[model samples]
Target: MATANTLERIFSVDYKSKIQPIVSLCIGGWGLENLSEPNEVTIDNSTGNIYVADSGNNCVKVFDCDGKIMFKFGDKEGKGKMYRPIGLAICRDRILISQSRNCILNYQVNGEFVSSIGKLGKGELEFINPLGLTFDESNGEVYICDYNDNRIQILSQELTYKAQFGQDNLHSPLDVKLTKEYIYILDGSNPCFHLYDYNLILHKSVISREHKLQVFIPFFFFIDNSNNILIITDYYSIAFLNSQLELIHRIPITQPNGVTVDNRGRVIVVCDGGEHHLNIF
Candidate 1:
């Protein structure tokens, strides 16, 4: 892995030259080809298929690498029904969706229903409003941001409860992402980012206001292969940070909600407002 200094030097080049629009997808609408208030996105690293949590439409949309519509799942009334799905994460062969209904729904990559867990509560294995989903590929564990619970819940790939942490420090955690060594969380209430270790030890907290950035509030974020942190802010911009949590660059965007990087190092952003389309760069 390259050091933070190296990554910073590499990203210091011209912004337009370093990143440019590569693809835009799903004009705003309720149709299958369009998206309404998409919340989160993730790439199937093995197949390069993109999975989007189409919240307003109450479904999940899958697209190929070229932004071609593959298929969509989640019905309003069915065995795999969904209600305002918000977060998404892909494990080995399953798709985990966190919805406002206070539960996490599990499905196969082919849209087959596997199982669902959680309900409205603060007890073990229960959630108030689940938001972000992230899978630890190394341990086959899934980390869920329990929104109202103010903590992160860990579950096995099989949907069984494992362990949880962060209630003492986090305030309305909106999203959680795990790299090989550290856990990154975006707190909507504190409007900051928290860094934790594998053992759930708090290392540091980054306040957006104190950073001297124009960010209003951070909604979601992604850590790329090189450990670069890409955060989508409510102020219509994305803030780039190095591994050491130093600001690298800030780019203009439109109502960005979720963000992720593809295997090819392309930055994919989900714009929930305005165009309600995805911008790939």
Candidate 2:
């Protein structure tokens, strides 16, 4: 669209056949070089579009797989409209978002406003600090991690409460990932990932002494088509682990946090690669 300052772009020449191998995600792209600080990131496999929570900028930015900026939403300081932007998720088509002050917002695939289904409350159904949101595609329910309230709330596709998962013992259930059978939680405070059945029963927990931040903000992790957990380290790298809790591989990335790998094994990570550069790997 408009000509703007473009930052660093180092796409491995070999990273072209299908989803080329990611040698290492060290530096971030220039697309985010000038972008405000970012939080979490997700990719729309159907459209090959990458979505980023530009938290510091108080908006969401979209990019293509080649790392080109498509567009961005939100305003500086997030005062006029967007405020304290936090976590994000995408369903079959729409995008779900959580902003500070207990605001839950949604947008359609075309970026049209859909509905905001949550608010601040002390009840079991409402949200205090809604940290993460993801749709359980296999079950037609959206699982939400309510940070301040310490609970995971599940809702139907239409935004009706179907079930709630979690307990006070769950420090900060940051993100919810669903496999064919159980719900995966990136327990932020414990800095570990825990699993539970769809019925809301804890199954297993894989502790990570990997890093302090990993211990805190496994902010976003997703399972691949092969069922391996691609965990975004609190620092620079991603660890691929099987269901057995053994580390299969680790790829060094930069300021890595919000991360997701799609059905095709395409990985997108959100990072302020350098001091203020937003890079997607």
Candidate 3:
């Protein structure tokens, strides 16, 4: 698909007003909140915080619920082997980081290092390019999206194996987010999404752009307070999906990666289009 930044001759529809679009809400009311090739974002309700995986910075930037950068963590220059860090999930009081280096570590709310949770290897509980992590708060289950292995592994809070879903068939599962009962996977290579129920049974493929199975690669996703609307972001656009997994409305953008919803239900999208775009509306 053509975008506003690439291949100038390509066509696009702004849908800025035809779809009753509203102006982009001024997040934090001001400041340069642009990002470089952002990868993931999550909203923490308890702390009223919004976290962004500033992958290019090799650090996670925590912002106030209103989009103000509160603090920055991790080394950004790819120093200390924090190169291309992925996966971030907030447990009760700490954050879990799946470093591309050798292990996933936890940190306190003050950005103090806690402890390493798992190692990186080919064996059990050993991760090779682990990319995403989520806490199944309902069951205290820890789910990991191991990209290199093309599998989503389920483990206990103690990091013990419970089950593994999607092995050879998964095409680079990128990020995962779970609710009380369902697990969502973003398969980038195949450019589709998958959902599994609590029993680990495949509920169905959620997002696609291919014919008869057309779905887009969802880099990240967030559910509203009601769990009725889903904000799915990929490299090129942000799409809003209904609870049934139907794309109710899709907004075209540049290289979008990080996404989240504000208190007012406004969508905050960080896009990397050379201009460092953060399109919110």
Leading candidate by TM-score: 1
State how far residue 274 of model 3 sits from its true place (Å). 2.2
For residues 15-125, what per-residue lDDT tens digits would candidate 2 score against the true structure?
123222442333233344335556777777678777777777667778777667677665343222566577877766888788886866777655566666766885755
lDDT of 2: 0.63
Residue 160, candidate 2: Cα error in Å is 2.4
- lDDT tens per residue, model 1, 1-281: 11110121123323334455779774789888788999988888778788889888899999888788899999667547899899998877888899888888889988888777888899888998899878877667888999898999988757798999999999999888876667888888858888898888998998877775445667888766354555455656778776666667777777888787676666677888667887777
How does candidate 3 fare on TM-score?
0.77
Q: Which candidate achieves the best lDDT against the true structure?
A: 1
Going through the candidates in the order shown, the clash numbers are 0, 3, 7
The CA root-mean-square deviation of candidate 3, after full C-alpha superposition on the true structure, stands at 8.6
Off by over 4 Å in 2: 1-33, 74-80, 210-217, 273-281
Residue 173 of model 1: what lDDT? 96
Q: Return the TM-score for each candidate structure.
A: 0.90, 0.79, 0.77
| Model 1 stretches astray by more than 4 angstroms | 1-19, 212-214
Residue 233 accuracy (lDDT) in model 3: 72
